[model samples]
Target: MHDPKKLEEGFGDLANEQQLVKEQDHTRNFDGDEKEDSRIGTNQPMEQNQDEQSRQQQTTAVTSKPKNKRIATLDAFRGLTVVLMILVDDAGLAYPRIDHSPWNGCTLADFVMPFFLFIVGVAIALALKRIPKVDAAVRKIILRTLKLFFWGLVLQGGYSHAPSNLSYGVDMKFIRWCGILQRIALVYMIVALIETFTTKLRPTTISPGFFSIFPAYKWQWLGGFISFLIYMVTIFTLYVPDWSFVEHHSDGSKRYTVKCGMRGHFGPACNAVGYVDRQVWGVNHLYSQPVWSRLKACTYSSPATGPLREDAPTWCRAPFEPEGLLSSISAILSGTIGIHYGHILIHFKGHTERLKHWVSMGLGLIILAIILHLTDAIPINKQLYSFSYVCFTAGAAGIVFSGFYILIDIWGLRKPFLFLEWIGMNAMLVFVMAAQGIFAAFINGWYYEDPDNNLVNWILQHVFIDVWKSERVGTLLYVIFAEIVFWAVVSGILHKLRIYWKL
Candidate 1:
């Protein structure tokens, strides 16, 4: 009999309490599920992004590493050429075999120019691999040609009488216009233009076959053939008449006459090459010291250069530029041949394939040269820039380049040639400083007693000549140590500091 209202109130309170408990539990479970789902959703994408980033980084590293790597073989080959240049230039007076031939035949020094041109072709192939526009390529080519031409004029244009005479200056009227670099500029311009124009014709995928590569480079080959044919026709067919030149000796000025009214004569004076140079560039503007002066017919001493013979030919004193216009025309073939090799390098991926192609082409050239030279169809003459000479030298260059590829790029034997590679890296700088006598001229500017007694002479006289007690031995050793080794060290330092002087 307690109160009915109180019992009813108690029942309502219990029901309300049970409903509140259920609501609290449901809210707690729902919040936990939401948090767990949120974490899973966020973590899945983050892990996936990390994996993708890792893959991209690996791909980039694998692909870009090759592009960044330097072609050690090519550099080594160029460096070897530079070394040979220094050796021949400095030691040639002592060793005639390594020196340039008087007129006809080949020597160690004869290969320098052709080798340089070949390398220029190779470089062009690499540099203009992906030209975006034609006008841009032309502009760049012209600019480079002008720079190279200017430098050639300054360096080899008789402006500086270096290593022998401290005087420096030249008469503009009698300035020499043709030289090594000038020839290089010409070859570079022509070959580069040929390549630039033919870029669009290159096949997207290289096909398989022995003669497959030739079809791709047919245009360049055709250009080369036309140039060669022109040279051949002009050299053989052009008529050369009597030419005369004036010689200015210390005693007085004297005029000499060369008796030549003929065609197809490869003699020093009568050749169409010299006649063209004299006619176009003028006698005074040609190279004053011609290699013909060293010929046995002109000089008292046959192999070694000395006083002229009493019965020396009239053309002995005549000015004849070796890098004349006609000879340079023939040089285009060398550049074109080099471009072919560069194509192999560009297209071939495997080391074996590249070596095989290079070796085969080299052998073919050598065989062709042998046939032409042996048959006397075309003599191997450097001064004339004969076709046989071009083929022989270019072939040798290819074989040598392949050897370097094997030793450095494949076998990983680079430490021994590191000095050469360094010089190759800064070849233009080395050419200017060491080969062109600029460094000698600079050192010669600072003398102790007089200009004759300079650091360069002192080093040669004391450190080398006096010590060795033999002129030839001392001269060779001095060149090897002072010029080659010294330049090598300079180039190495520059490479370490990343200071490259490109033209």
Candidate 2:
């Protein structure tokens, strides 16, 4: 124990081990740092003196990966939908394009609802990915569905007109059961349930490969496809009392009549969708002022057919909502497709991979829809929520979503689009406010009476209407300006307060 030479040797060995451990730790830390850097952005050469070319390359790589983790694209896409919705809804004899197509074809206004529904699907998918408990997910779905339905009824339901007179409350006879919010709520419930059950039963592991791309949960596809098939089967096979145009000369009046089965019954009277809606909710409970009402005085060609005669029964004055009962079944498919897209967004790590998938699928859907429509297998009718219509609109929605994703999420060009994000973040709030006439009432009350008369009318009449020299364009711009300023301020305040109105 007292051997000096042997003790010195032992101490030397211990010192050597300590040094080795330090070196290993240093190496591990360096490797970890490198990995983290690469995860955020590509690693660049750290030379003592780097050339300009290499420096430029590094800059490019750094900028390529956006600094923010938020998906600006979704917000922007939703915001765009909301903006267009307000614009179209507020349109005052301004543009036909802002209005829905008479019956069969689509207008710019028609895309708003389907696009919103698709976005809802995508949102649900993203949300459910982290929620492991099926009961919790179902509870969320049920509560949201009920809330949306109740609010829809309260906002748009036909209540007593004499509320100011203190006569009574809601008129049960005129209550609208199927409305925009009601339909959205129903669709959301069905889709959420499908996703919940599928996610619980068919949990899947991600396959490694670019071309191996598919839904993480295959049951989602199965559910969506089955819904789509159901819609097609029902449309082709369902039997109802036939509708036909009846011209009465004695009373100098005309009305649609029910006759037999709907074979070539594509008009307002003979279509199965309108027939079912009338039977279910009754005509008085449906939308009374559809875009078709304005087009009643004019004769036009049937969108499905080439040309129609003046007396071709193209006039349908009945209150038929495009978002009717039967068409909503196919709407589920649209939302399901959106869910698939949301899965893609969550699963794929690389930006290129996500963009590639979106573009390919979107273009493919559009082409297929066009083919089906041209072949007359399924006409693109928004009123019926035809298969081709669903495909076409959903495809357009995908492409739009991808474009926003690229601009806001990938390129980091976010500042300029913050307004849209603001509005989008509070979508339900804005929608409810607008639907409840809060915004309209506020804007209408903002007027200060002037010497010449009403200031609001004066500005609208003299400034926009007179300057633009086109009532259609001027009135549209005025409403648009008002909406943007008013909603933007409200949304901005909410954003500053960090208030997000969640379902």
Relative to the true structure, how large is the alpha-carbon lDDT of every model?
Answer: 0.79, 0.66
lDDT of 1: 0.79
RMSD of 2: 15.7
Instruction: Assess candidate 2 and give its lDDT.
Output: 0.66
Tens digits of lDDT, candidate 1, 413-485: 9999999888877778888888888889899989887887898999999999999899899999999999999
Task: For residue 286, give model 2's deviation from the true position in Å.
Answer: 2.0
Model 2, 1-503: lDDT tens per residue?
01111100000011111122233334554677446545445445566676768766765675464432446676667778877877776673466655677666778888987888888777666556544456766775787688777877776676522111222246777677777777788778887787777765544456876555455566767777787877666666666675443333576956665456654345555566776787777866776555554443433632211233455343444466667787787788888888778878778878998888888888989999999888877778777888889899999999999988888888888888877877777777777665344544444444456333444566678878899998977888877775665676788787777665655
For model 1, the superposed segments whose C-alpha errors exceed 4 Å read 1-66
- Least accurate stretch of 10 residues (summed lDDT) in model 1? 6-15
Weakest 10 consecutive residues, lDDT, candidate 2? 6-15
